[model samples]
Target: MSLLAVSNLAKRYRRGGKPFAAVDDISFEIGPAETLALAGPSGSGKSTIAKLVLRLIEPDAGRIDFEGGDFLALSGAALRTRRARLQMVFQDPLAAFNPRATVARVLDDPLRIYNIASRAERPRRIAALLERVGLDTSLAARAIHEISGGQRQRVAIARAIATRPSLIVLDEAVSALDVSVRGQILELLLDLQRQERIAYLFISHDLGVIRAVAHRVVILDAGRIAESGDARAVIADPQSAVGKALVAATPKLVRTSQDAS
Candidate 1:
């Protein structure tokens, strides 16, 4: 069974006193432990779709079924409980987290809010979360702003996994990092998915990154799906105008050793 199923999803917005579709009739499915990437140029509705799936914003039309339930129909306590199985990692950790908050505090919120651990056990849980993300436990004492960009992103990831989510919506999560760090983070994500059977709704414009981590790719253009297929196949021989343009614009298509295997 599909872990996440989005069917005929649409979101509209007012622009210059006229209504426009930001996400129009989009549909897709993600299986357990699979990586499905949404790749498109700016303003192509990738981030908007991510927000809609996470319920950060409501969609105007269509259905979202997650784990065999109507995700859009969930509310109140049920919604909150269901949210524990879904998480997000944004493009910028500095903007996503409180700069003044310590790493331990950031990781502790999920455990406390979900009642996953008692207060006395939270510090140990936070340390374990840090270790899980390839960070030193001592780093937990540092403030978010005090850590390097890469470290802050790692902390963001650790926090996301604290609740043992089945799905993670990553909107340009690795775009802000340098090449070497980007590869490391991608490797970490692949490792986590392999270990925990987590699925990812990866949103990004970088085709190379998508090729490295995504089993399937959906290319969007102006809020509509232009093409969808196996990541390597579609990228190697783009069939749509937008897809061809995107591949042409990219000077290099570097494939990581990971290669979605």
Candidate 2:
């Protein structure tokens, strides 16, 4: 069964005293352990779709079925419980987390909030989370702002997995990092997906990055799907005007291990 099913989803907004669709009649499905990427140019509603999927913002139309339940119909405690299986990683971890908060505190929030670990057991769990993300456990004592950008992003990833989510919405999750760090982060994501059977709704503008990680790619233009297919196939020979434009703007697609450094 599909881990996530979004059907005919739509979100509208007022622009210049006129209503416009930020996400228009979009539908897609993601399977367990799969990576589905949403790629589009700026103002193309990629982030808006990510927000809608995470329920940060409600859609004006259509349905969200997650794990075979009506995700849009959930409420109160039911919604909270269901949220444990849905998580997000933002483009900027510094903004996503309290810069003053320690790494341990950040990781502990999900464990405590979800009751995933007892107070007495949380320290060990936090350590394991850090280790799993390829970080030194001693960094737990450090404040989030004191860490490097790559370290901070890893911590963001660790926090996202703390809930043991079935699907993660990553909104430009690796775009801000340098090439080497970005490659590492992408590798970590792939490894985690392989290990835990987690699925990703990866939102990014970089087709090169999308090609490296995504199994399927959906190219959005002005809040609507313009084209979609196997990640490699669509990227290699884009059929839509917007898709072709995006490819032209990007650097040559070199088949590498995410161009790791």
Candidate 3:
């Protein structure tokens, strides 16, 4: 069975006082240690799907199952317990963190909340998490604003993996970074996935980034799925108009000299 399963999921909101569906009956699954990408233009409901899956907002209708458990049915402490296995990293890493807190405290919060470590043991765990995300132990003493964009993002990633979540919903996690930093972050994520066997629900509009990391791709357009399949296959030959546009918009790398006729 898939590690995460979503079926007929939907959410509606008022736009100009009329009900508008942000997510409309979308369904997909992410297997263990797999990366599934959600790609689309702005206003395509990609972020909404992530929020629904994370239960940041309640879905108007649908079912969400994680590890064979009824995800939508849980509440209060039960929901909190389930959430430990499902974490999220947002587009803005700085916004995800508390400016007042140092990196060590930020990483320690998850371990504390989940009771994964004692107060005395948390510092060691925090340092290990920093190292895991390719940061030095010295960074633990720095505040969110004091760090560079890449470092801040590394902190965000560290916090997400601190509890050793089985699945991480990365909502444009690397979008805010520059090209070089984005490439490094993607490589870090792939490495972590291989090491920890963690599955990813990676949402991004950048087709190139998605192609680099995701094993499968689901294209969303205007609150519904436009196309979905093996990443290389769909990207190579897009069947839908939206899919074709996304593929066309992706920045292609120049071919090597060996490919020249």
Q: Clash totals for all models, in order?
A: 0, 0, 0
Q: What stretches of model 1 exceed 4 Å from their correct place?
A: 253-261
User: How many Å off is the CA of 99 in candidate 1?
Assistant: 0.2
Q: Per-residue CA lDDT of candidate 1, range 3-119, in tens?
A: 999999999999999999999999999999999999989999999999999999999999999999999999999999999999999999999999999999999999999999999
Query: Positional deviation of 182 in candidate 2, in angstroms?
Result: 0.8
Task: Identify the runs in model 3 with alpha carbons over 4 angstroms from their true place.
Answer: 253-261
For 1-261, candidate 3 gives per-residue lDDT tens digits of: 899999999999999999999989899999999999999999999999999999989999999999899999999999999899999988887788888889888998999999999999989999999999999999999888899999999899999998889999999999899988998998999999999999999999888778889999999999999999999899999999999998887877778776733
After superposition, candidate 2 runs with Cα above 4 Å error:
253-261
Q: Please, what is the TM-score per model?
A: 0.96, 0.96, 0.96
Query: How high a TM-score does candidate 2 get?
Result: 0.96
For residues 1-261, write the lDDT of model 2, one tens digit per residue: 899999999999999999999989999999999999999999899999998989999999999999999999999999999999999999999999999999999999999999999999999999999999999999999999999999999999999999999999999999899998999999999999999999999999999899999999999999999999999999999999999999999976577777544
Candidate-wise lDDT, in order: 0.95, 0.96, 0.92
